[model samples]
Target chain A: MTKLLEANNLGKRFGQQTAVSDINIHLSRGEVLGFLGPNGAGKSTTMKMLSGNLAPTNGQILINGVDLLEQPKQAKAHIGYLPETPPLYRELTVREFLVFCGRLNLLAGKPLRIAVDRVIERCGLGDVQHRLIGQLSKGFQQRVGIAQAIVHHPAVVILDEPTSGLDPIQIRDIRHLIREVANEHSVILSTHILPEVQMLCDRVQIIAHGQLLFSDSIDALSKQMHASSLQVQLANAPSVSELSAIAGVVSVQTIADSTFRLHYQPDNDPTERLVSLAVANGWQLRQLVAEQHSLEDVFMKIVQREENSKDA
Target chain B: MLNLARNELYRLFLSPLAWVILALSQALLAYLFLSHLDYFMQIQSQIAAIPGAPGVTEMIVAPLLGNAAIVLLLISPLITMRLLAEERRNESLPLLTSAPLTAAGVVMGKFLGSFAFLLILLFMVLLMPLSLLLGSHIDLMQLASGALGLLLLIASFMAIGLFLSSLTRQPAIAAVATFSLLFFLWIVDWAGQSGHDDAGWLGWLSLLKHFEPMLQGELYTADVAYYLIVTLTFLLFAIRKLDNERLTG
Candidate 1:
């Protein structure tokens, strides 16, 4: 797959405070990349530079192999940005705003109308297209913001806090729209919500204090989080003495009849042997599986691990 | 470039602030035109009585266009202040800046939008001249030249306002700064009368100096060129402001 965006040594500084430092990233088409960072981790800064809203204080941005500084117009044509605030004109109707955005990209005549129409439908904004943006709910306003960004058919779509002000239902709706857009457009989603990344992103980059803590797929991230292990529940219970004898098994609890939960080291897969032992012990083995570690837990454990290491 | 220009025009027209400004400017222009014409007529009969009012022709044309120019200068700032400033405040500018259109194109597009609104305001004052000199030999060529000069004058004022507007995201600050800057430049030339030749540099630099000769139906190449240069320079500066905004915003 062709990399749609690459950042080399990307950094931004306001006065003496550096917001981002020595960042490197490569994104390909058809990938939904989550940018998970604590507040002020430079996620928005990086997205801003990528989207051409702010020029990088240092380093370079390459959009579809085109240098952003050398060929900004062409590079920017490849990206669509929804800033942290959604950059909306409250006075304009959603349709009018999208049409204006279409014109800004120099798309006009039949093509502009078509692009605007396509985005409105894709973003599920058709219902409120004629409503003034200020009159729309936060959910619809965010949709309008996304519609404006994609109205020109950019290859890379950067969303900063796309679901920030949204309720649970609205968040789900917007997430669905984003994933749908990602089929045709690469996406960069930045937010502090870890589960959001797990639900929407194919790959995740966790940033903290201007540095990346980890970058991998959701499954890989959960696997790499070795400190915070999951507690598994099985319908077949091993004898109390049998459970205590299993190596690397810290403890086991018989929460329900014929049910046991085991806490073991994350890397060691003891589910099979435990089940086999239960079978040998004449305990009917019904279910034996390790609970998946949530992205939020993995994220916090990784962050805490880093902080502890620093403290040491 | 054209599409961006058209969008800017649409944005301006759709804004309630734009209509309010247009109406207010039109009313002000209409009032000033009639009042200036009344003053002109009141002094017209007096001019014929005097053995020779040294420069009656200049006197006839100067006050009308001069007062009209003043009113436009005052209102252009309020109208043009929202051109780019509002976009930035409303966070809608990123949509335009990220477009393929050059910054110069966007700036010029907005300038035209605000200037078009000013044109409607100017159109309201057009009748004042026709009302006063119905069938008299009112020198239509002079009238046309004065109108051309006024248009250019307003265009430059709008450019100045737009440049100031681009410097900030606050519409109120943009409006106030544009008004203060334009008004200062407008009257700065009058300050020249109290000083010697060495102190007249500021007056010559003032926009009023470039516009004064045009109001009298006299089109000096230097004054015309000055206004054009001022308009272009400020417009270019406004474009640069947007270019920097992409980095700083």
Candidate 2:
């Protein structure tokens, strides 16, 4: 896995306000890295710095081992960026716009034509190739935006909120196209959609309040989503101390006269022992289920924990 | 840079704005050209009676070219207003900024794109003077000098428009600002004429003052240098503005 892009200690300031700071990120070939953040969390700012659209106030960015600040032209040749607004010339047709984008990335002659055609086919823009971009539907226009970003076959494709304003079906189609694009090129997508990161990204970086709070593989994030507690309803429930005495139960909370919530470690289980004790002691167990945590819960917990640590 | 210029021309021609401007200007200038020619013909014998009177080139072609300059000045902002301001407003400037291009490349590409269109308009206006060659002998050198003057003048107009365009995100605002600046430079010579000797600097700064010499069949390097300096200065300003945007945006 060769690293196709790298940014170290990236920071940006707008006059007296800081937009982003101490941000480090990298992407390897054939991998999709999701940038997860809330709105105004500086996701777009970081994307602008990485794509060479805005110069970072401090830090260094290397695309394909070339320093962006020292050799921007050479380094930016490997970057294809789709800004939040799509950066399109609405007067030109889809095909014409893509060809122009291809030429801007230094493609020409047969190669430029071939690259434009390949992107149009890949992005499902064949039908609207000759139609004016402004005349097309929003979905088709977004597809044109994506097509132009990939037309030059750059090594790194940086998309800022690619599915931000699309309908559900259009989002599905765009997601499918992104999945296909990830097979050949490295992709760094900034989005606030949790399910989108879960579905498409190999790794996720969670950013909030202009700082990165978490970075890990998606598997690790899901591991945090595993069941960590149980809700139980029992006739003639045992004492809170008695439930706490169970081998795997970490703590006990009384929910009601006949119901209790049991906390336990993910790898440890107390369900079997509690059930046997209920049968022997004649304590009737009515309902018992593992409480599952949603990804939203995990995300919020991580963000909240960071805020708490800062407050301390 | 050439590729970007081609794209600019492609977009310009694709819209109805450029075609409409071209057609309207050509028709209005052609009407002015023929009417002036008509007036010149009626006074041809009276002018021939006077010794060393102005020729057909001075009476017809020079004023036609002068009118062309004013016509282009009114319309050049329309062509250049969208060059950068509209792109920034639409948020499409990131496309060029993110590409492997320098600020100079983008500025020059836009400059040349609109410059090419204005040059075409200049050529069409020159055709009206060239048409007089069939019946009467015209001063080719004066016509050439006047054409050169108009070329430099419009180039400076475009540079001014381009620089102003880069300063804002609204096309209408860019157009109005460019017109105000160019119009001020055009009329600044009036201040010098009305005032004392100290107002010579105002006359020197007037765009029309340098342009007047070339329109009168007088070609001076100093006049040419003034236009060149104005054009280059504004172009540098535009390029610097774009580079600063990348840094501060």
- For all candidates, state DockQ relative to the true structure: 0.47, 0.76
Candidate 2 docking category?
A: medium
Where is the poorest 10-residue window by lDDT in model 2 chain B?
B5-14
Over A110-181, each residue of candidate 2 has an lDDT whose tens digit, in order, gives 999899889999999888899889898877887888887888888999999999999999999999999999
Q: What CAPRI-style quality would you assign to candidate 1?
A: acceptable
C-alpha lDDT of all candidate models, in order: 0.79, 0.91
List the candidates' TM-scores in order: 0.85, 0.91
Per-model tally of clashing residue pairs: 1, 0
Model 2: DockQ vs. true structure: 0.76
Worst ten in a row by lDDT for model 2 chain A: A291-300
Please give the lDDT score at residue A235 for candidate 2.
Answer: 91
lDDT of 1 by residue, A1-312 (tens): 898898888888887888888888889889999999878788887887888878888898888899988888888888888888878878778888888888777687999989988988888888888889999999888888888788899888899989997899999998898888889999999998877887899999888777778878877865665442334443555566787577767777767766666777666767677767766876666665556555567657788899899999
- Candidate 2 iRMSD in angstroms: 0.7
Count of clashing pairs, candidate 1: 1
